[model samples]
Target chain A: MQGLTAHFGGITWAFVLDLFTDYGLFLVSALGLYVLMSAGQVSLGHAGMVGIASYSAAVLAVKFHVPFWLSLPLTGCIGMVAGMVYCYLLGWRLSGFYLAIGTFAFGEMMINIWLTSDYLGGAIGFSGIPLLARWPVLLIVLPPIFYALWRIEHSRIGLAFRAIRDNETVAGSMGINVARTKLMAWMIGGFITGLGGCLHAHRVTVITPTEFGIYTSVTMLLAILMGGLRTFWGTVLGAAVIYFGPWLTTTSEPRDRLMFYAALIVILMILRPQGLLASRAAR
Target chain B: MAEYLFEQFLIGISTGAIYAIVAIGYNLVFGVMNVLNLSHGAVMMVGSFGVLLLFYLGIDNFWLAVAFGIALALVTGLLVERIAVRPLKGNWWNIKVATLGAAMFLENFVTRLTDGRPMPYPRPFKPVYYTIVGDFEVSNVQLFLIACSLGLMVAMMLFLRHTTPGKAIRVVAQNPDLAQCVGVNVQQTMVLGFALSAALAGCAGILNAVTFGSTYPFVGQFLGLKGLVILIVAGIGNVRGCLIVALVLGVLESFSVVAGGSQYRDLVAYSALVLTLLVRPHGLFGEEGRTGREI
Candidate 1:
């Protein structure tokens, strides 16, 4: 209680900002990620790709002297292209647990390669990525992204992706282009995560490989899981819970925190197996 | 360079055998249950912890430790199924999520209890080596690990094939609905499957502690991940496929370490899994019908 009181100001501000920043971004990204995962293509390593996009934007803005406006979307585009290339290379072959493996490999490979390279600042990682992201920026950027994704989620294309998630063979029988739908989801998911990464990089003003490892991916998954995978807003709620839940709980132990997350995910799955918001089953 | 490479490669194979034992645990649960037991690796960790704690209590006997580890694992398996798994039955994703929770709980509990320190595990076999066929020198412990792992796999197979309970398990693995209909006591079978997997994991944990010299509190994540990767590489529920892939990964990882470096060893394992999955989703020797065999 004393610790909480002592850190009250920072905590309150962080809570509000986290609610806006992390929660908003996670909501935007989860839709895209859910789309891909539902298409029976799991990319466990996408957090790295998200990291790459974020860091790339940061580097371009801070080092290569690119304008923030120019770097942000460009970084996102790079992420999209990488996602496409990744999907093309392994998308068809990916399904079920195997796709999860491929994603994890991609993430691990990217981390290893980046960790060794001096250009991405390697082990020391990237710092001073420029804090161009602000409340106004969030207001301008987040809603549109969320609204766009929400639109997509309700579209026929979205339904097709959901179909694949439910049962690929059946989806194929119904003439849904499983591979193409997956490719699109991957691309879009990458773009959104990249955008989130870019914003995160700018906000933190520093980035490391650890910023985009399995933990980040798991966090995103947890947000989606906790919020309710079925609805877009649920992921937002989940992100808020994770983003600020720690600050609220204020436990100094990282292991305890992780345990909390792990326990939460399990409990959520058991209680609300369809996910927090529950994606309405494709009729 | 040759000597160094050979030593590292040997190390890789031994580590791979440890992973194989854990993979076998995942495969059994998956083969029977059709659900990914994300906690499978944690169970192995529990086994390690159980042995370590018992050993700390002045039980210097290696055999005694191993037996205790196995017994602890069996109990842990049963408890995990009852608490974490059974409640989430009928929901596959829930199983993964629940197991993950249980895993996190056990890992943190162990870490907190052990003060996050690395504890030494007494070697089951001496690290003394002998040159078998001139150029290839292998440690006695390595031989022991390989033999023990193979022996365990074979024993598991024999149990699955010959024993009444084993046949019942096979039936459950092959077809749970039919197995239940035929009065095979599906619930008990599931429990047995969990127990067997945990017991094997316990053995592997002991073997790993022996070879690696010490067990860390956070050992479960790495071990679990390797086992999960092996299971994916072998396909979801193919026991034979998992064993072969485990060995193949072990050998390949050894070669990659020989050619590249140790920092990227995990890189090789995950990449191999990705590549294998791309080429063959059913794994190296997996069949389409091999969904759930152990649970």
Candidate 2:
């Protein structure tokens, strides 16, 4: 009995550590997507977050030899500023379908640039990135970030975000300053996502543009929406499922994994159209 | 030098027309439903693959294969509407993401079937380059692509203007409930709209395949993405704008390739989109007030 319990405990703890590193980074990135979606923007361009941050961090770490400690937070700041600029310059004027297309185009364009720019290693991807991030880095960074996102979700700005999401005309009439509120959401989301990107870059010794494409964006969105778009806890559940679900369901086939994910999304959307935990829109 | 430029322009316009047709497909669906069908791109690939399938089954006539291909695309588009879309009705965000899943499914399914390889597509015309002037050459295939796209656009416009079903589609676009009250059969109109849109995508796919002289499972990704870009840049529901913008983008891309190499051709289109978002938030030809901000 002792032997079985110890083995079980060992397996559980190991899985949890793996979860904190791999899934935790995804959660941080996903939280950025969550905030953006909360404002009803529905951007497909967000893969740029991972692309921009990971490459920047990788470049800074390898070329400039910036200490790992410095590069991580720097990437977040860069992402925040970049996000705000994109929102302010490009996003402020658009909404609905146009915004989706614009963002999608932007994301594709970045991928194109990544594929062509030989300076950034081109299609071969940037490799030999210092794998500085581990369990501790995520451990320290995650709790506070999770708390911050939760508070932001419930804050006055967060309330305005919900209002805008529920109905923009009403939210505007109620004086939500829809554009500025959206900007804030983008900035915060960008920052967190950038942090995730930096950690992710350091987690793997190589970085490829494929990691930051439409599928990644969709995958992040899936996690958030599936967990229930309204709460951080649901996001945690979503992160958990995405990490663990594949273990039970996925076969050795490579492309089949994407098919599995797409099928899962379709099935989930059909079963729980409002999301797993979504109930009445919070009053 | 001028001849070379002219040759490039001719090439650009033909490809642009192909894009215009694809955008028209998206415009039809978006106009009527206000939902962007993410699977539109995959369906374009479906059209090409559909024709390829017919060819495999011993269909020797190129035109006949095309007919079957368009039919296949129409079916797939309708299925997207029925399965990925309708069940998540009125939930705009859910519909968008679900359709995205549909796109992924189609792209990957084809990827698996073909092992992600580019397959050679059959062309209807023999290789024949026509010289309009000294060294200003145009291929018979280019002329056919240009003519068919223009012909299809004109036909679609006429259909929308003159036909009862097209009018019903217009009415639904204007207001589904009002159209339904007037006995327009809103659901049927929407299905028809999906069919027409998907058919157009089918046509565009074949045109693109013939342009490249081959097709691949992933070809739809770029083709479909370009369609959406042109759709917005041209302004929603503005058919004329779609033609003009798509042609201009195609021309610009052709020039950019000459100036900055083919690897950077996409920069032109995406930069244009970002610039449009910045300078003309309502799109180049879109109406001024509909920034989509309202609930």
Candidate 3:
């Protein structure tokens, strides 16, 4: 009991445990973004993806009484299938700015729907969800997920993703199915990110569309970008930075905080456009 | 009833003209350099706010204030290009995010200064409604807005087509490497492009503040998005198309306010944007964007 309840640095043990849980959840989402970025795809809708899983998990929990553990993989499967289908159908036509804007629009539309829907409790969002995804659950789940992602990062398909990221034309000429590879990235990334979202919803016990918008999505992108763009460790490091940077700075005011983050991002881009973790590619 | 509808149509024209200028701003930089200049909208807001700040500082002449605002916007645009765009050196995503960060930085800086409050705009003259046709009313401000935008648009079209600098912009747009090889000062021309676009944005931003009655820090986010939406729907570089679409959407919005209340007004434009992206991502007149993807 004493070991479990030990405090550190003016922070209580429960807060530390929660912080760990939160960081893990963010890492999962960051890794999802990492997969897509590795394939040179830009999605400004990760918050919406997380929202989808959260709402789906909420409905599953409320309507079907699905257990927490079962719902985790269930939501991920749904996200994977949804991502694959969506990318295969309409995503192939979109490449650069269009893809980014389309995803942004997707996020906006989701927010609109949530705000207007009565079933989802509209703007306020529905609550009273069971907090089944405790820190222990996060601990049990995260290691395997990270290990799997590391394995995937080194796999054959991962190489295809990188090939496409560098240059699609060359990747296509090499007989890699560019569209299919992108779809694979989105699908797998969506799955892991979906789990991240599910864990978040279950932990918070309440989900609101307000918390998931373009700003949040942009912050997610910033977090990952801050860590590093291409490296696997960069994603993890980004999650950590985003999770803890503000807390360490002790910036309590929202306005100051935004300005700080904005300045950091702008300065970082100017100073190290390649991000902190330089890629293996010779500049 | 016909006269009332006509008055509504005129109202639509004024707003549409403003949108046209905003879209043109987007097009100028995009056409010449393939840079999105996402901060274009914030620069727009800065122009109006510049005028407002000067007014508060006791600059009595509105025209002079407007001139100063244009200059301010030009500086902001150049700063954005320098900080957000030039550093990345053609990395699209980094540039996009950086520009967005710059925009966020500017917006918050202003917001912090103002305590996130909306400031009342200062117009050159008080609006006076004239009975143009037996109870059909027209404000001098509206007429001025419509006339000013039309004149600016015509001037821009002529400038881009006739001037040496204009041709240089077109040449640079076609192929920057070739343009450089041909001894055209690419960097200077790019600066000229930003100046031109920023000037237009300044005009639109001030016009927006006048029409909307108040100016706020985040005003650009919504209005800037509308400009981007117009740009996308009109097909990135199509100035004429942008004008037509902006006017048509404005009229549609006017009529929508009549038919379905003001609530559904934004839906008309946003849905159109989404549809265009879904149906034709290249924009209606765009030649498959090379900035984002490969052929």
Candidate 4:
């Protein structure tokens, strides 16, 4: 068995484990974004929620000495509340590019707050986080999350999201409560993203404010765009590509890597705007 | 205390002038094309680099370097329109995302070329300070920035109001299909709009480099968004409102720095943006029911 695994470019078991954990995190966040996009809303601020939860959970673990199991759910609840409050207060009023900018501002605000606060470890990043999120934990956690998301996607609410995405006025005319449905999308997306953050914090054993900035938000967006936004499996495929595609094309020069990512986005936007795994019904 | 306040206010006005100039270009592109040029900031960075490259090549004339940079930016703008905007023209979301990709490409390309180091801008014009009042001083650069920005704004106003092609741009902005039906050369006008917007961005880049005495690959990242914020505050397509709102934002940012220190400056600015969007979604000068429409 070892020889058989070695034949695949001599990749180590540990590297494979790391890849799985990374995919788990990316998949959760990508799905978080997919939920919003399905409702015809784009948030350039999903990273803020991730950052908030990461910091909250990391603080609880490192400072309060709370156990991982309790801290994780508490972190998720914090994210849920923050997301709901933000959406109810601000997100409901904006749409399109206005919403994009609004969310972008929110993301920046989170980063700035993180950077300025010493309690969150500021620019140096919070460290000494226990690595509780192993491959087994991820394997165990992902299935239920996936099942729940799958259920949500096929539910009546999912139909409402699609209706809102297609046309808000028409959706309103069709008796869909656009505001409440969007609010639900935000809350659900936030909780999932927060869960991803918790997994990331424990898996990586360190968390930084910069880790959850506009760049990460944009990457999450790219994953959804590349995967095809309409389906769950597409998001999984996108998360896979987003995580491994760059690793597969690892270059010695960091500049080349950035260029490669940028080129991929540009080419993808030009050639396959609907993404690699667009739904058949979309066309 | 009063002297400090005066100084900060002066600084705010100068910074706001820079924002205004950049916001004007951003607003122009949005008005004519109805597509947010997310790459506008990256284009401005390219312009700054263009000037730096010229200076390295022994070009000491500031005006010459500025002209070269503006021309380079114009070309870049035209290319972006061709590649990112024109192809995805009626698809609003696609256009926004494509421009974002273009921005990422330009920023990374420059970062790669420059090796991510801050380049010192060539100080062609010497700083001359004058005492305005009791312990209040103003530099020649500040005055020049304000004067140049206002001059450009006036020139743009005249161009749009008087010239035939300028009028054609306005017509196209009003209704592209109508303009095309009336034989206004919609394609050329779109290109021209991009060129004009980019030229303004280039000018702002030169001014910013001079004012800050440095340029970097990511300089435009935040400033571009700030310009957009200024536009939003001023109303999407209103040139006069853009100028006023940019100044207000600049002053507000400066005051926030004085009140809460520099770290809170961005927090204050963005918070103000959220507040503005909430309180006056149509903007200070935007028409009602026209808040979210294509400019």
Candidate 5:
């Protein structure tokens, strides 16, 4: 019994470590999307923001010889600015389905631009990115970020977000600054997504426009949807399922894996449309 | 240079006609159901594949193949409505996500079936070019496509105006509960609406397949998005408005290709959509306060 416990303990540590390194980016993205959805706006273009950051960081680090640490936060700032511009331009005018479509178009445009530009390494992809992120780095970064998000989820701002999400007009009647709250959600969400992108660029050591296409955005949305949009921990669980579930399964081929993933999503949606961990109040 | 631009403009018209057809179908579904069918493009692809399969099976007539393909698309549309749209009727966001899932499923399934290679469409008609005034030439194929698209648009307009089912559909679009109260079969009308929309999309898909001389599984993705853009630009539920906007989009797309390279085609198109959204959130013909919901 003692020998079995020791052997399992050694394997478990390695497995858990690998899981964190592999899924850290997805976890971060899920958190960003959770914030947006919590405010009752769905962004189909979160992956586009992530792509912008990844490319910016990779180019700055590799071409300009910027320090990795500086490049990371710089990418976050760029993401925040981009998000602010996007929200200011379209967030007020569009909501619900229209917003989804507009953001989707934005995502497609980003990928198309990346695909067409030669400086961004256009179809062949940009490679030789320095590996500056790992399990340890994620561990140090993620907990504090999670704590911050948790605090936001419980604060007055969080309460306002929930109110707006439930009904915008009512929230406005209740004296909440609906537009300002929505923009704030976008800003924070964009920064976190950008940070995730920088981590992904360093970890994967290569970046392609294809990696940040509508499919990536859809997958991220699916993760949040499956987990439950109302709670931060639910989003974390969803992100974990998305990143690690396929790895544990026996699906080896890429096509088969996608098929399985899509089928799983359909089944999950039918079985639990409100999500697996929907807050009781929301239900 | 003038002649080349004229030719490009004509080419844009043909392509735009296809976009108009797809957008009309999409607009119809959105009008009646108030839900965007993300799988509409996939349904179009299925139509293309159906026609291609019929041709491969020794159907020598192009129009016959088109008819069978449209029929197949109609059936698929009904299936999608039953499975994806109906189950999540009340929840708008869930319906969108489910339809997206359905889109992915159809696209990936077709991709796997085709082994990830594009299939060349066999041309049934011989290439015959007719020289027009000012030394311009138009092919019989292009003329056929343009004429057919216009004819179908007219037919659709007439159907909606004169037919009993068409009037029923419009009634439902205006108010489903009221339509039901007035003895209209809402379920059947919704199914009919899906069939008609899918039929239009299928026709557009076949026309596109013939125009390009090739078809693939994921071809619908871009066209589907473009159709949505056209629907938005023209104002949702406005058929005539969609036709005009689609043609303008196609012309703009061709001009962008001439100004920049072909790679910037999508960038130009999507940027136009974003700009339009910024300038006019309700679209050109859409009523105020009728941006997304049916009023």
Candidate 6:
């Protein structure tokens, strides 16, 4: 909702401004959720957790004079631990709806803690982290990340994880270490989500608890749900739609935006219960 | 320090009682229907708003306001089940998302209708403190809240164990298909289950208003999450577990606030859920008695 300014401006600002941030956040967040969900862990709170990571990274870089390179990975590691803990607790036994609730609660807790903590700049968030995520950085990061996600989802490990999601007892009987696979998925999901947060922190140059809360998490889920939860490319497509759809459609009111999203989720779930790309097609 | 600790303990019990009521509703729905009611808290919020509306309309009597609120919550719950949940029955994930949709719709709709202003709910008892044990002072409202909550919980347990409809509900919960074959009317049972759950949540809303003295549209947001955590802590699909866990949460929250600050109160519930779930997935008390419908 916070639109960027283009003072070094002109016609390019309109094209560049909308293209970079709006579409950019949408794409990465969508891709991230898609990959995570395909790996058999649905992160309803990735938005909030990622926001925390990004804000943490940004604050260390700007206020504490920590180097960006040092700050980013450190933020990622923190998120990794958070994700592992979340999984180690709830993920071992819970799946589907229960897992979603736990993750969502964890996300809310993180946001609340961030909002109340003065050291993290409280609700106002931190700003002015160096903008190191540019086209070149995107070019390097996007391909490898996408490739890795693709490779993992196609691997035997991915099959085992999916089997767990489908039915854990059966998978366990088949010799899959459900806990280990789930934990690994959680760590990877958190690590990537943290990476996204770090980049987001640098790109926006400011972070706030408001940015991370339920809305962001819902939006990220929306991206995955709409594009297609199972297919890797579907997530990218879904992200693009969620990111750029409103701007292309209409910017009427905030309520309208919420309505649009709600409508999108309802439609997708009803129309494609197996997700946008049918499971048959994915197989 | 002792006095402060004692005072906070009283506050904690009362607050925890409200959570216990909500958690009980969640436990009932989960126990019977096997579907999580994401809109259970939303229905409770509607109840709080219903009471506020009644109060605004000159129905200032506390009990009268509560009755009005409960009736409204009952109708809302029935309608919610018919429109939002029934379509997604038999599919757990779909049901979860559907309820989430209902929750989103209700939350945003309320926010829009109110222009984001919190609806003020008058406390049943005004701020009046009485010293206890010659040292600590506990608010009368807090004591009343705790008493009423414990009473309601007992009443629920008695009803579930003794009443005809309650037995029917338990039977339906244990085996809906078999219950249906025995002419239990599965659809009607689901409706009743939701209605019963919603009514309890309404009571919780009233009690929460009594404790906090104000009701915001988004109050249920946190309460919903808390209920979910309590559900897990008690072990999903277990009513008795929910009650015990909720009390534990209340006591811990109270002590945490006393030991740290009010801001840290949530840390207690969140941490407890994280820790307990890590150690025991089915919860300390949960023994899965066939969650959801028969596959």
Query: In DockQ terms, which candidate is top?
Result: 2
Give per-residue CA lDDT, model 2, range B153-179, as digits (tens).
Answer: 999999998999999998999899999
Q: TM-score of model 5 relative to the true fold?
A: 0.93
Interface RMSD for model 5 amounts to 2.6
True contacts kept of 4: 0.47
What DockQ does each listed candidate score? 0.46, 0.54, 0.42, 0.53, 0.48, 0.32
Pick the winner on TM-score between candidates 1 and 6: 1
> Residue B66 error for model 3, in Å?
2.3
TM-score: which candidate is best? Answer: 4
The whole-model lDDT of each prediction reads 0.74, 0.83, 0.80, 0.82, 0.83, 0.73
Residue B182 accuracy (lDDT) in model 1: 88
TM-score of each: 0.90, 0.92, 0.89, 0.94, 0.93, 0.86
Q: Show the lowest summed lDDT stretch of 10 residues, model 2 chain B.
A: B286-295
Candidate 6 structure quality by residue, lDDT tens digits, A1-283: 1332332223376676647655665566556556557656776677866876787677678778887667767877876876787676666656665566567767777877887788888767766678776655566667877888789878987787678766777899999987788888778777777777877887777777777766678767766765555657777776776676655434435665555555455555566665565573442
Docking class of 6: acceptable
Question: Which has the higher TM-score value, candidate number 4 or candidate number 5?
Answer: 4
Off by over 4 Å in 4: A1-13, A279-283, B291-295
lDDT of 5 at A234: 80
- Put the candidates in lDDT order, highest first: 2, 5, 4, 3, 1, 6
How do the candidates score on chain B by TM-score?
Answer: 0.91, 0.96, 0.94, 0.95, 0.95, 0.93
A212 Cα displacement, candidate 5 (Å): 2.3
Q: In candidate 5, what are the lDDT values of residues A168-211, reduced to their tens digit?
A: 89999999999999899888888888788888888888999988
After superposition, the stretches of candidate 1 with alpha carbons farther than 4 Å from their true spots are A1-28, A38-40, A173-175, A250-255, A279-283, B1-5, B125-137, B288-295
C-alpha RMSD values across all candidates: 3.2, 3.7, 4.2, 3.1, 3.7, 4.6
Question: What's candidate 2's DockQ score?
Answer: 0.54
lDDT of candidate 1 over B179-269, digit per residue (tens): 9888999888878888888898888877777777888866777777778787777766667777777777877887776677665676777
Best-fitting candidate, measured by lDDT? 2
